[model samples]
Target: MTNVSPSGPASERSTGRRVIRILIAVLVVLALVVVCFLVWAKAVMQGERPAALEAWTDDRVSIESFDDSVVMTPIDAASDRGLVFIPGAKVDPYAYLAKLVDAVAETGTTVVITKPTLNLAFFDTRPLDTFTRHAPDVDEWFVGGHSLGGVKACMMAADEEVAGLVFFGSYCSNDVSDSDLAVLSISGSDDGLSTPDKIEGAAHLLPADATFVEIEGANHASFGDYGVQPGDGVATASDDEVRDEITDALVAFWGGSGE
Candidate 1:
């Protein structure tokens, strides 16, 4: 006699039930992903980078071509200091030139502003590895960013090789609060997104040597060239004024080429 398995209506019903459960689970997972995508899309900024300004830059900063699509290399090769910047979520890579190239570029520090996936820095925090491996000429290296980019840079600042970390209207997420690396946190008094209160509260994460500077009347949206941010406060300072202040503080912290 040969042993046989159940092959009747009862077995068929059980198999059908398992198949239905699997399909429901897959559908639930797909729905969750869709909801997440929807939320992300709603937060996306639709501003375009004002590229015509690049032509006016003239000889100030020579925009260099690199192998990585994730970075915009605006190099002032005369300087010894280098900064790898991470752009804020939904902001264009070139938009950062408004602040960085205008202020720090002339200070003799070459700046590389990374274009993160969907303009979100957390998605590609380590893209600077490409430049670090290839650019041996830069003796001093710093990692910096605006908003979410700054928080992510906190993680990179832990590297023994990174000389310092800079934040523009941003704060660290307690990751490098105790790090010995030099930290410069700049916030705008009018920035509603990264409010002065929040930035002050985050000071505990920074080392004793960390420097925090607040711009008199700048807003979070002014940190980049993009138009007004959704939840930003009105800025009392012109872009030139705020940018200049930020550059001054940055140069003081990093000892730029002018130093």
Candidate 2:
């Protein structure tokens, strides 16, 4: 009988398999990097970014109101489908969503752009809580945000009383549980932050009646007012157009839902 070491052939074979797996992973990663590069190039370098945004924002305007925990910047509209915009991390709520407010108002719906604490950053739900407390008779209330603001919207939808939810340049994670309410998920084609795959996945996070829209060649910054200014350098879309498209879709969705 020949006695073979238990750690000899078996270990060698295991190491070989491990090496092959690692090589495969490396190749997959490299392929992904290439694909990402191509997407970025096509969406950002060669796409209509600033001009598209400017076309919408050139004639934008807004109105404001001073609430307790929120300075509501309502867009010009005549509809009853109310919308409350929550800004992204480290951004000024009212300032960033001014154009959005105006756009929603133009659609005949009321809009309130909130100003949260700490310049409206993070996934804080306290602002929503405060707004709910102060304005108890708004009739209808929809919540939406950018980046972390999206997360907050999900949180609000999950626990708080909201008519709907909207996400701009943001993703709805698996943590959301608001399936009964309406949802609208929007993203830019060039938005590296929130990819189509992620945005598509968000559909599952909401009810079966949710809606999704993608703006080709839009960047993460363009989802906010950054893209509105001519030389803002924050994104490719102008603030006016971005907000207009967003509010239009939101109004349509909200109105269609009939809730």
Candidate 3:
């Protein structure tokens, strides 16, 4: 009979089992930590309660009676250039992009934010008509929006009324015939809602001279100020950082020529 050491096979098996258990335990602890951080961040940074978001309400920006289609919030600013922000469908203007108005205004442009009256799939251009009516006196103009609102910016620029266009997370439908307007399309590589393919398609629709910039890690919702739940979408650095990039690009684009 062959003599076998008692510690050989048994010791190896025991060590393997212990190593597996330790790995499992470490994984569980890491998952819990992630869950805890997400909860804390959402509660402090992105509270869902109506009251938490209500604190941002502005009586000065509120226009009680304008054209039925459009609502504008005029910001205090230092430049003659006008910046209009039209929001996407089913979204409250104050909820997402409101945190960004002051940031855009800091670059020496007046902000005119539009809150849509109707809710649904179909987009209405009537709201823009109301804005055109109000800003007849401004010398220089710039239009921009979040998501579908970016399409509206393109539409406004195409009309030859505005000097430039800024699109945030918007797609260009195949029917882009307006090349006279200057275009700036900004999107993120990780944004699931608007893929890189869609952004490239939109770029093709623009004139060859149009400007395009892509943020490496941003998602659709990240372009706006509101912090989304962790798993719901891609997490970007911060709204302030993204908005700064946009404003600097816009200011530089306009600085060269009146257009």
Candidate 4:
């Protein structure tokens, strides 16, 4: 029999195995670092939580969490109008409960607030489709969002499941100027981010019949319970005052224009 030796090839194989293990260990460490960084980044993005969300607590309102969304329904039988809301980029979806609860209670509309991926709606644009599947009982469905979230909502409104669109301090980058979908655009007078000038300038992107309303003393961050956002103008209206008008605007829109 030929003499058998294990050293040469065995040593090379062992070296390759060690290299593979070292690479895997390095990858694991990098993954952990990335995870920790994302957590920290999201936490840092949070702003002062507004009192409006707490103040609107009503027993008539029922709250539930669905896949990455918060559904606020009236405890009593509500109007068949349904709304899917997208929060502003990096803002907590819960920040809107105060601002939206009164609207839901006052208008008898069922509202679902979709929490976007990493708080950015553009990353996942099918929120209307997702909300529709969850709200089969709604006779009519509308999609709305704040800031970047609204932009994505408008993008998704092309779906047949959506009957209307609402933009809270947001604009449509898509050319829906020809669509017959009812559009209600609410903006803040003092909003530096989605300023009045910018909104008016982009009016052509929307249908000619779109309803545009501006809250007298409101600002960009006034649309949600998150306090002053970076690069936002100083709000001249109290949070409650701003929210009240916003609720009224929504009620009128959903009942009149969006019907």
Q: Please give the lDDT score at residue 209 for candidate 2.
A: 67
Candidate achieving the largest lDDT: 4
lDDT of 1 by residue, 1-259 (tens): 9999989999999999999999999999999999998688446554344532652364566665454422323354356667888878877666766566655555677677775665677766355566665455678888889999898888777654788888999988866755668888989999999999999888888887898899999999888777888889999998789878887897787666655
- Candidate 4 residue-wise lDDT, 139-200, digit = tens: 88888899988888888886556778899999998888989889999999999999999899
- Candidate 2 lDDT, 113-221, residue by residue in tens: 5665544435244755565444444567778878767877777677777777888878666455435677788888766666666677666667776777877556677
Q: What does the lDDT read for residue 213 in candidate 4?
A: 94
TM-score of 1: 0.81
TM-score of 4: 0.80
RMSD of each: 4.9, 11.8, 14.5, 5.5
Give candidate 1 regions above 4 Å deviation: 1-11, 14-18, 21-25, 28-56, 65-77, 125-127, 175-177
Count of backbone clashes, every candidate in sequence: 1, 14, 0, 1
The local distance difference test score of each candidate is 0.75, 0.60, 0.60, 0.81
Kindly report which residue pairs in candidate 1 clash with one another.
177-205
- lDDT for 50 in candidate 1 is 57
lDDT by residue for model 3 over 1-259, one digit each (tens)?
9998669888999999999999999999999999986564333233233522332464324332344323333344444666676765445454443444434444545556575545321345564446655656567777777776777667666665677677777855544445566667777777777777878866777777878888767777766655553433565556556656665666665542222
State the displacement of the C-alpha of residue 255, model 2, in Å, after optimal TM-score superposition: 3.7
Which 10-residue window of candidate 2 scores lowest in summed lDDT?
40-49
Q: Is 2 or 4 the stronger prediction by TM-score?
A: 4
